[model samples]
Target: MEIKEVKQRKEIIEPLLEVWQKSVRSTHHFLNEKEIVMISQYVPSAFENIPHFIVGYDEQKPIAFMGIDGERIEMLFIDPICQGQGIEKN
Candidate 1:
């Protein structure tokens, strides 16, 4: 496992979006299906505005990612299959 800063937004946007949807669906059960769909549409553009983004990988596959804005963490998501593996804790 390794953690690294993301230098290119386009490179992992799709996978990160998948991770985001999965993570949100599993955790944010309060959101309706329509709400999820609505939010999904904006994820790409919102990600582009994140000032600092990083990803965690196992081998060559991305397992988790985080977006930070100064001292605040805007987003942190882990692939559903990769959850509870302490990827976020590290």
Candidate 2:
């Protein structure tokens, strides 16, 4: 996998949104389908304004990503299919 820093939100947001949704479904049991859908509506704005964003690509497409604000990690998601492969463990 190749890790990349994203300079344009548009270049990464759509693919990473799919990653975020699947990752949330795999682990965020507190959220129902309706809540998840509702929350996703704000994702684009957040991604666009986040201080930093990066993605992990597996040869062809983005499979994982993280959003950072200053020193804090604001968002992190890994495609459920790629979870546990330690794609971001380092």
- lDDT (C-alpha, whole model) for all candidates: 0.87, 0.88
Alpha-carbon RMSD of each model: 1.1, 1.1
lDDT of 2: 0.88
What RMSD value applies to candidate 2? 1.1
lDDT of 1 by residue, 1-90 (tens): 899888688877888888899899888999988999999999988778889988898887788888999999998988888898777888
Measured against the true structure, the TM-scores of the candidates, in listed sequence, are: 0.91, 0.93
- The digit string of per-residue lDDT tens for model 2 on 1-90 reads 888778787876778789889999999999999999999999989888888888888886989889899999999999999889888885
Give the residue spans of candidate 2 off by over 4 A: none
